[model samples]
Target chain A: MSSHDHHHDHNHDHEHPRLSELQLRVKALESLLVDKGLVDPAALDVFIDTYETKVGPRNGAQVVAKAWADPKFKAALLADASAAIKSFGFEGRQGEHMVVLENTPKVHNMVVCTLCSCYPWPVLGLPPVWYKSAPYRARAVNDPRGVLADFGTELPGDIEIKVWDSTAELRYLVLPMRPAGTDHLSEDELADLITRNSMIGTEIVTFPAKAQEAAE
Target chain B: MNGAHDMGGMHGFGPVLQEKDEPWFHGEWEKKAFALTLACGGLGQWNIDISRHARENQPPAQYLDNSYYEQWLHGLEVLLVEAGLVTEDELKTGKANGKSNVAALPADRVFKALQQGSPYAREIAEAPAFKPGDKVRVKSMNPPGHTRAPQYVRGHVGEIVMHHGAHVFADASARGEHGVAHHIYNVAFTAEELWGADGQGGAVHLDLWEPYLERAR
Candidate 1:
């Protein structure tokens, strides 16, 4: 070992060199809370399990697909989102007050929580790291086109972009426009095309060439 | 409060880095942090607004430097200490000083509680001050406490596009006053209005409460 490297090992002999610093901190906090009866370890597991298994972007895909397949459902979703979403048993937490913004040929809708990472958990699930990151939060409202460029999303100049800053308790979901060539697909097949980003309004749903060929 | 968490228009953070097929929790610690925060929240010592304030009220340098879960952990620590559920020494030592009298959230109830998340909307007798399509101006005032109003929208004029019923006022709720409701509206501002000549060709909508706006004359 280099002499400089050896010099920095003076007090490191007893400490855990394997676990990262953050892991150690978390371990310490969890044990402390559990010991004092402030939190149950099982409850923690439930939280993790719930998000990992029961909830996610797939739920949002189902909603989007249903909207695309049924005009009545689409009207219901745009009119009273909370009730419509509740019908699918996706009601709670970050989704109490729901507003589904429909993307059309003229207007594109994007969602962001500039103040904090407020997201619609019931539908879209926990926010992706980029959504919570500072760059997305700071620029999504001001330089949205620039931000979209980062995601490789280029929109036509004539189409107006609408950025929704989730500054209150109300949560928003972007109902992306169904791709033109997707009419031949079933609701399940349509749901397969909906990505979390599309629901967040960062990307537009595009009919994959392979899928179009299969349809043909 | 005008903290770093209220970043809307200020720049130089760089392009967003998105993970390809990212997992729900990036690490083992993140899961714990998320769970601990939510579990403690069920203890009823503090409200969601207060917990948010705890995160946003941190030192600007540290607040911006920490990762998403790290920020949540820091806020959880602050809330625990202030709520008298845990102590600084206990955190450092990784040992509990004594068993807290507060009841821990039962594991079985976690699902139901999560499914029935706290609803902030409340019914108020008075009608909203403005309606859809009504022009309004965001009042310029800086309060040194928790506020949902982003700094970029302050002093700018916008038009109301939707009216959300009265909801619990976050500013007051952060100060421990519960049930205070205010009418909130989705105010739409042109990109040019918010950013001047440098603005992009688009619009920004903010869910602003009644107190933050006034009729545009």
Candidate 2:
């Protein structure tokens, strides 16, 4: 029964004064390092720069794309996800026990980590800031329909929405159904249709041709 | 000190302000500082001894000053410097240059890579000890350190829906600060089993580790 309260402000004046000393020490140490010139600030800068520009959920998207293209692969994916995923060559932390949930006309899947940020890092990379936020974790389980509405996803009442809680042992990634008008595309072309938001069950993969033709 | 997952009870920790649409790394230094303090306190003697007593004995305020990620960043910074990966000066320079030593990669690429092959491509191993449709009970016991199993769902019984390959264990106590072996599984449970009649209306499934479960009768 949760309703959207977009006006809610989570920040309040509950500041604790105890951390001032620690904050000062950190600032002082940072200043000392800058003065010493032993560190190259550019390295940290480049790291952030690279992540924003290059690293993200492309791997997850590729997995979804391959699943859509090959029926045998999709069957294998649903039957033995971890092994099927390995056939494509992805691996990393929290990805050992990979499970692929298909979003169909009757059933939709969404993933959340109520314990912590237990994500499939090998596929989805680091989770988005919002994924780890408290509001998302709480509302996702309590009022899933309302939460999905916030993300602009309106599910039909007849469709059963399954919200899966990711614990430490197993991690989840959603394989959203392929968008319409993508029947003739190749696997590589299909890969571009997937989005990170789709894998998280927030949005669907939209056809690029529709947008391109509309733009004209 | 409190557990790492006890973040919800902290003040000003309910939701984030939507209007503050700043860059992702806003207040980066503050976050790092918070993580360092928590790690020092949570890791206890192990961290302090390694740090040569650099961290003070007093714990910081529960959640008022910095967010959890900030604390995580801070902890990483301290550990990296301690491990001689980078220095305090290097961290500062990285910050000033708008870079982070540890930045996440693109989700799409990461997912693509994972699907390309098994993560442990170098070490080929045998299949898992269990299979689908097996009745298993999640292990019930509270260890003294970080665990992947949530307190609410411990000891619950579920069916083995899928068998994921080995990766890293989430039980930090057994695997040291960071776990080594991965004992992963997808366990499906009926809502009634977990929450009794209240949850009987629908089914609730879970993905758990092998160590977290035992063969259920």
Candidate 3:
């Protein structure tokens, strides 16, 4: 090893080589909380598991698929998203005030939180890493077309892009236009095709055949 | 406050790093941070608005440098200290120095707490200042405190889309006060209004509290 590299190692002999500064801080905080009898480490696992599996993008996908299958339910969802979403047992916290945005042929909708990471946790679970990233936050508002392009969602020039800035209390859920030739599909089958990105307006839900075509 | 968190219309943030098949949490620390914040938040000592202010009131450099959960951890620490639940020395030593005035959220109640999430909306006595379809201009005042108004939306005119019932004003709630209740509206601003003539062809809808707006002629 070079002499400078050896000296660099010597400069930080007190610090733990494996853990970063932030990681060490987190460990310290956890240790203190556990030591003080303030937190149960076991509960932490439960919290993570709940959001990770029990409630997630699948919940949102079901809401979208159900809306696609039932016109009356779609009307209710369009009229009052907060009430309709609660009917599915997805309510509270970030989703107390929900607004469903429908994307038609003439208008496309996209969602972004510019102020902070205000998302519909109950319906869509926790947001993706990119949804909360700095680049997406700034660019989503300034260049909606560019942000859509990054996701490989290229729309016709005449269709207007309606970007929803989730700046305040309300969280948006984008209902993408149903794919063609899927009229025979049931709600469960359609839910399987729905992705987290499609409900967020970054992409459109496609049939299994189209997905395969894109893959090829 | 016009903090780095108000990053609408700003530039130079670079491309978003998209991860394929990403997990819910990056590591153990993030999971702990999330649980601790929610658990402590269940204490009901301070509201969500106060917690948000704690994260936003950081120095620009520190705020930008922090990851999502790091920001949460940072804010949780400040709130814990400010609420007198834990001392700085206790935080540093990783041990309790003395008897704590606060109580921890019991493990059994974690699921109940998660299921019964805190709702921000509250009943208010006053009528909203504006109604739907009315044109209103966002007040252009920048305070050095917590505010929901983004820097880019200030002083711009937009049409009201819907009226959300009266709720707690965030600025007052951030300071641990009983903020006066007011109506919130979904203000629809055209991209051209917010970003000027060169702005893109689109519309940005925002849910703004009554205080942040004034009727436009």
Most lDDT-accurate candidate: 1
Ranking by TM-score: 1, 3, 2
Model 3 lDDT at residue A74: 100
- B24-57 per-residue lDDT for model 1 (tens digits): 9877988998999999999999999999999999
Q: Which pairs of residues collide in model 3?
A: none
Ranking by DockQ: 1, 3, 2
Candidate 3 per-residue lDDT, tens place, B45-84, comes to 8988889899988899988877788889989999989988
Q: Write the per-residue lDDT of candidate 1 for residues A1-216, one digit (tens) a residue.
A: 001111111232232233388798889999999999989999999999999888888888899899999999999999999999999999998999999999998999999999899999999889988899899999999999888877777888889999999999999999999888788999888888788888998877777622321110
Best by TM-score: 1
lDDT per model, in order? 0.88, 0.56, 0.81
- Taking chain A by itself, what TM-score does each prediction score? 0.87, 0.74, 0.86
Model 1's i-RMS, to one decimal, reads 6.1
Can you write out model 2's per-residue Cα lDDT over A56-86, one digit (the tens) per residue? 5777777788889889889998887777876
- Worst lDDT 10-window in candidate 1 chain A: A1-10
